[model samples]
Target: MLKVQEIREIIKLVDQSSINEFTYETNGTKVSMKKAAENVVVQSQPVVQVEKEVTAVQPTQATAQPVQQEVKETVEPTAKESTVNFDHEITSPMVGTFYAAPNPESDPYVSVGSKVNKDTVVCIVEAMKLFNEIEAEVSGKIVEILVENGELVEYGQPLFRVKTK
Candidate 1:
């Protein structure tokens, strides 16, 4: 099994290189990555083994289950949704884990109803073990938090909705 750090390293190398596709398989685990325009799609497959038993009275069958995993880098919001009231939304700049606070024990940078400026650090997005402080690019009041703390956020995913002053 590949560690999280190893997987991240692979992704980073693939993204920086000019290669369009890459694959690795070892010990029943397969990791495949493909570059699409500006985004890199990663997929993993894990092998499963099953055992069957047979007897004179009855027979049993064994089946192998398929494992599939997909990572989506971007999500586009639909125009039909009812988010027009907000003047601005604080969006994540990368695919990573969203952190509302600097650390586990600290208070969140901002919450619903909190006033913010153009440069206020609204949240942190941790990618590849790097903590990036995301700023509220517009002066406004936080009206909604679109994502929960510790949630996996995709690139350009909205983190907060703000009503500009």
Candidate 2:
């Protein structure tokens, strides 16, 4: 178990780092936290992935060109660079158990370094007897994963953060 001070420190660190997500495990206790968007969908099938429409939680869209330019130009000056601190958190649309891979022996849908687009199948969330494919709504690199494979996830729970240009 973690002490109250430790938990507070972790929260502070997450905010300061602009990390969007963080996870820690020690002595069998694990805690995952992420800054999530309310309407981000974390499941999509490959066939229908391109057509999936998500509710726009925020009525704003950041231009892709400038964001990319800033990232490239600032990367050399600072390690963090112009990497947008914003997080596009892919949350479970419904309750289910998260599966990193299609099956135990298969490769995972996405990993830390995976570059994903709106149609990328990030993971599967199995609910009841059906498996849902989680899609990324933006183009970016996965910066962090918030849930463990086979862990139970609730509706609107964050699964990963994509670092957009």
Candidate 3:
């Protein structure tokens, strides 16, 4: 039987590393872990696996239960970079969908050469069914948008570049 502390340690190790899937098997214990989005799913069973084959095995003693947790992870996004020179970028605060307009037919919040101040809303980042308005933190003229509408964005991913005043 694996201790609770040991299981927690394993989860910690998996969360901090880049590996998305992990599995461990021993004499009487088998552990499999997979991360989906910001959540970690842990499955612990008393079974044996050998050489890419799975075999049913019984535990020698009592077994531990499965555990699941919501891990706050800032996953990396596949982004293309455009030329930027001395421009400040407006970044997303969470991993979600990015929308340039409030609705499908509405005009975008800002575009190239649009003058904006710190209080101006530049875009919206929707996460978990909630739409959050994103603001331009610096007074500037919009230079370029780095992401496409309806694209998935990661935390700290640059959305727009602004040539500050």
Candidate 4:
């Protein structure tokens, strides 16, 4: 049987590659995975016009003119880029529903500012009816929680950012 860590690595590799599906079988154990097709919705944004003064200079003459320009500004940071200062990241090993605790009635496994070690269980990702405990994987204080409880997480999605000792 393949170990959980090995399986996680395989899932990461498969998710990053162009292959849409993969299967492995050996010694009576089998693992199969398929990538879900994504639907992209494109929304049109209203165009903004900015009026600016421009100076045109030539060897013989110089002239000033008013020009109209369209400029779009965005300041959102992506998942990896947003956590640049963090020392470690706890990521989901498979696509599943993320659970902050073992059950709804229980307290969350970890919260912001919670201290944890490499072996500390931080959350659970339920895939195909099986609950897989996700560990801290690094000794650190939780700097941020990237996903809400019960959210659907994709494979290798960052769950927590940690500031390591």
Best by TM-score: 4
**For model 1, what is the alpha-carbon lDDT of residue 78?**
26
The sequence of per-residue lDDT tens digits that candidate 4 reaches over residues 57-120 is 3343365544445445544322234734688889999977789999999999999999999999
Model 3 poorest ten-residue lDDT run: 70-79
Candidate 2's residue-wise lDDT over 55-111, tens digit each?
433334663333121111211111112343546888889766779999999999899
lDDT of 1 by residue, 1-165 (tens): 778887887688667655577765555677888999999999987644444443332333574544444443433332225544788878889877778999999999998899999999999988777889999989989998987777666577788999999
Between candidates 2 and 4, name the one with more favorable lDDT.
4
- Measured by lDDT, the strongest candidate is 1
Residue 88's lDDT in candidate 1? 85
Work out how many backbone clashes candidate 1 has. 0
Clashes of each: 0, 5, 0, 0
Q: Relative to the true structure, how large is the alpha-carbon lDDT of every model? A: 0.78, 0.66, 0.76, 0.72
> Of 3 and 4, which scores higher on TM-score?
4
Write the residue-wise lDDT of candidate 3 on 2-113 in tens digits: 6788678767656655557776554467688899997779998766323333344544458754443443433332234467664698999986678999999999999988
**For all the candidates, what are their Cα RMSDs to the real structure?**
13.9, 21.1, 16.9, 12.4
What TM-score should be assigned to candidate 2? Answer: 0.49
Worst 10 residues of 1 by lDDT: 71-80
What TM-score against the true fold does each predicted structure earn? 0.52, 0.49, 0.51, 0.54
Model 1 steric clash pairs: none
